[model samples]
Target: MDTKFDLEKISQNIVYVKPVVTADLPTEVQDQVGDLDQIYAVHNASGEQLALVADRKLAFHLAREHKMEPVTLH
Candidate 1:
């Protein structure tokens, strides 16, 4: 079987990677991450949080896997 992906469409949007303080998160979320002091957050252009990952590298990887460009936010 064969499938097609529209390269242009996939590359149209950009995802931003930001560092989030674990303490600022809710207690449930903090508990989920255990001893992690920080986590990487991936957001869309409108600033909606998409994914919270363990590291910067994984955050970028998540965006690339979805075909969106990744940009760092300090």
Candidate 2:
């Protein structure tokens, strides 16, 4: 899939905001949002959405495939 967002820049900006594959998600999150397909947005403490992702796994896979290291939280 084609994406406008630059995955490399995104990874450098905030790894936590980075997307992850379904297999990468924690058990709790997986249970809550079963089969996560995409990440709409990520908000900061200021309540401002920083980034918008179309496909979660796709994005993560792209990043990994491209050798881009995204930040990971928890």
TM-scores, in order shown?
A: 0.83, 0.28
lDDT of each: 0.91, 0.50
lDDT of 1 by residue, 16-64 (tens): 8999999999999999999999999999988899999999999988898
Off by over 4 Å in 2: 1-52
User: Which candidate leads the pack in lDDT?
Assistant: 1
lDDT per residue (tens digit) for residues 1-74 in model 2:
87699766654544334444545556775576655664433434334545445555554555456455444433
Residue 5 displacement in candidate 2 (angstroms)? 30
Model 2: residue 69 alpha-carbon error in angstroms:
1.7
